[model samples]
Target chain A: MKELTIGIDIGGTNTKYGIVDRDGNVVFQGSISTAEYEEFRDYFNGLAIALRKATESIPFAHKIIGVGVGAANGNYYKGTIERATNLKWKGIIPLADMFKEEFGIPAIITNDANAAAVGEMVYGAAKGMKDFVVITLGTGLGSGFVCNGILLNGKHGIAGEVGHTSVNPAGRFCNCGKRGCLETYVSATGIKRTVYKLLADHLEPSELRGISFDNLTTKMITESAVRGDVVALAAFEYTGRILGMKLAETVVHTDPEAIFLFGGLSLAGDLIFKPTIKHMEANLMPLFRGKVKVLPSGLQNQAAPIIGASSLVWNYLDNNKTQLQEEVY
Target chain B: MKELTIGIDIGGTNTKYGIVDRDGNVVFQGSISTAEYEEFRDYFNGLAIALRKATESIPFAHKIIGVGVGAANGNYYKGTIERATNLKWKGIIPLADMFKEEFGIPAIITNDANAAAVGEMVYGAAKGMKDFVVITLGTGLGSGFVCNGILLNGKHGIAGEVGHTSVNPAGRFCNCGKRGCLETYVSATGIKRTVYKLLADHLEPSELRGISFDNLTTKMITESAVRGDVVALAAFEYTGRILGMKLAETVVHTDPEAIFLFGGLSLAGDLIFKPTIKHMEANLMPLFRGKVKVLPSGLQNQAAPIIGASSLVWNYLDNNKTQLQEEVY
Candidate 1:
């Protein structure tokens, strides 16, 4: 019989689940409205029923052995989701235990960025690498660090929140109740703000000049920059410079071999990477100069999160089990 | 037979060695002037002869099975010391191999701070912690990180160089050819520089007014602060604030549980810790607020480095051997 794992990627509005084999392929995939459910348990119960029907519909002999979840504020150590700002669930939800109860199979849960890191290590550009960082630039920035080949959950399982790390600490207001967070300047929303700021600063005409902030999306900025819109181009340059500077500071922490940029903003390609790499190199400590590659995600954007969730299940079940070194001499 | 490990700490001016048991007790100890020898090979040869004589004088029956050296620029993977500016040695020296040839035993080497971190895990304040960071505040700042209960030897073995991380690209000149390195504001030399700068900026009469930069020391500053000197107090506040700010930034990278302060500048007690902890907590991201502790090394100042070196041997041999997780999902 074929062994299959369920990979669930939970977002603020949508929740996607996939039945995947060990090779990161999604055999069957479906989505549900996450924001509609008043409670997460209700959502999970409905999701379990839908998943079972989908599994039965599959035309192959397979046994679902484990489940993996990638969600906001998902804590690997506690298997709980605690106070995720974007999620409808307000308090700590025992996510992994819910999976176990609903599916009668072992489950592992980690924040989305961590799942992405494991996915990158398992199936993306970071394959075969032991030390690297994965940065997700979507609505807000999120990060996961694989140091010495282990995804860092840290002491509290909130280790890789690079987006919340402050660049100025007093500059920009963040939803996390902090100021000058790197995400405020380098994420998709961050770039849009930059574009608007640039538009106000310079009088040069561009495609973005008359667009309002609510209507002007990151896609418009990318398109405008590609069309050689000076304001849009400067916005990307500024965003990359901030991102690169922060990454240089971050390098001293784990000394990652490579950093992978994923999700929405990274789709801009060289518009983001060139300035980020240049500024990162310029700000880097002398030792890390000419080392540490900043690369785009290996997998295409559309199926990446589901692939990452699937990879997480496979990774937790069969790969990277660390023997706890508890013996103190 | 009683097994003993040789723990050697190499400094610019002196080299300290101890014959230590697995319990971290020094059975025998000796020192040699490191600056006296022009060639590193001749120095090692002479030191070996001296160590042999010292070993023969020991009253107990002990077999030296392994050696551990904590030095500047020591690389755990390569087993070499590469371009240690402070040492008389000018280039890469096969330090571990040198020990092996001289003693006919296995040898391990790592930078001094990493040794301290391992030492802290094995014998000091950070015992039982899976993730922690150790900062050494000596002539220049240095750091070692223990992540997932293993000494982080990153991809290149130079992972924990928190000292070289910059706060501002144009703020301070560092010996590492980078401006605004953390060490320039937190080490023993760093605080001294701060004290002098404070004196230059202030007009108030103080005990530190006429002291030449050459004669000024961190010890004098500490004493002045204790004596209620405003200038010295302000200098410490400034230094601690900078250290704490950088540490807040550093925390996102590794998410350590506790931060252990070792070496000269740490001896200032609350003069540094109070402000450092205060600022660190203040600047910390909301998730890590009041969680990470800034604590002094549990081992006393005089014996800590040697003990850390000895602990490195025991920790490396008897504990914390990581099975490389090379399997990709």
Candidate 2:
């Protein structure tokens, strides 16, 4: 029988899953209300039922070889989800073991960013590239680093956390209880924060000045910038500059060949990429300048979540024989 | 015959070599003047003659299995020393190949910091730890990052360069044509800079005030700090705080279990370690705080250079069956 793997993306509100073939095709897919289940066991029970029904309904004869999951604060090494802030589940949860029991197959789990990095490596832009970084610029920035063809899970499976790497000690307050984190200036919400700061600083006539902070959206800013709104353009420039500087700083450590921007703020395209590339080059050491590429994530954003989740299992299957035995990462 | 490896450390003024056993014992060693030989080929030939004579003089009839070298701007992947600022070599020089030709053995070469990191992993503090960073604080700063038990050579073999990562865009002029590099505030010279700045800022009488910039040394500052000199104490504190803050930032990237401080400045002990640990913890993310250890190198400072260079060969021989084949580093 043709083999397929299941990819499950667990978010705060919605939990999405997909049955995917080795070629990145989604054979079947579905979503469930995560917040409605309340209990952790109930949530998995409902998911398993839905997945089972979906598998039975598929027209093609195929076997699910494994399962992969992506969630906030997921630990690849320990296979536990530790105190995920967005999820109602409190404390450390044994998500991976639960996944294996429910699926009756080998299952792997890691943080969404790491999953995205694997997805890029398996079936997207970073194919055949061992050294690259995936930066997810969503509500909060997330990062996954791939060094020498292995995901950098670190000693405690918490190594690739560039989002929390503070850009400024006294710049801005972040939700993670840290001051001036990179995400505070570079995420989708980070761009919005910059827009408001620009608005408050300048009485310059602009479309964004009319919108209140609550109603202000990154989409509106993008649209405004596309239409040549000075404030919106400046916001993108400021955000890119901050991101570029951090990328330059991070480059010296990980030394990735390419850095993929993969979320809502990234949709701004050249508006974000141009200034970020400019500042990053300006700040980089002489040896690294003109060498590193800042590119868009190859995976389509709408399907990226489930695709990333499933790629973990595929990666596990591919490298399990050698990587698992030798590296222990 | 018993197996052994030769380790060579190439400096601007002197070239040091050691015939070391697998257990970190130096059975024979010697030094030659590097600058006296105007040509690179002649220098290697002269050094090879000295090594051969030293090998014959040794009482034990051990066979040299391989050679490892450490130098400024050494590239591990390419096996070349490229445009080293301190050395007279004008461009990329194939040091490893030359070593192999001269010694009739397999050879390896890496930057001094990376060699030191491998030395720690093979015979020093990080013997069993898979993830660690070694920061060398001498005339300038140097760094080697080992993530997931493999040295991060990056895409271009220049990845582990935390010393050049700018702490401030406008802080201080670095010899590398960069501004505000971490080395400017954390090396032996960095402490001296801090001392002079403190003396200039404070009217408080200092023993250092009478000394010229060229006359004052890090040893005098260390002695003064030991004797409870306020200005000297303040300089160490300032230096440590800067180093600590950079360490906190760096920890998020490679996520080392321990960071070993080596070379001249690291000799100051608690004067550097205490404030560095304090500021690093303070600036760290909630997860990493109190988790990372800042320690001194396990090797004696005087012998560390030769030992670090030589350990590369032993590490190669030990892991050649597995690590070198798989990782290709």
What is the lDDT of every predicted structure here?
A: 0.84, 0.85
DockQ of candidate 2? 0.74
Q: Which one is best on lDDT? A: 2
Off by over 4 Å in 1: A319-329, B319-329
Model 2 agreement with the true structure over A275-325: per-residue lDDT tens digits: 999999999887788988999999966778899999897788787766532
- The CA root-mean-square deviation of candidate 2, after full C-alpha superposition on the true structure, stands at 3.0
Q: List the residue pairs that clash in candidate 2.
A: none
List model 1 lDDT by residue over A51-76, tens digit each.
Answer: 98879866667777777788878898
Mark the regions of model 2 whose C-alpha exceeds 4 Å error after superposition.
Answer: A35-39, A59-61, A322-329, B35-39, B322-329
DockQ for every model, please: 0.70, 0.74
lDDT of 2 by residue, B1-329 (tens): 68777788887789888888878888788899998988888887898899889889665666777788888878888999887766886788987778666666767898888889988998899988989999998778889888888877888787787888878999988877789989889887888888888887879888778888888888899999999999999999999999998898888876789999998888998998999999999998777887899999997556677788988877776656675434322
Of the true interface contacts, the fraction found in model 2 is: 0.68
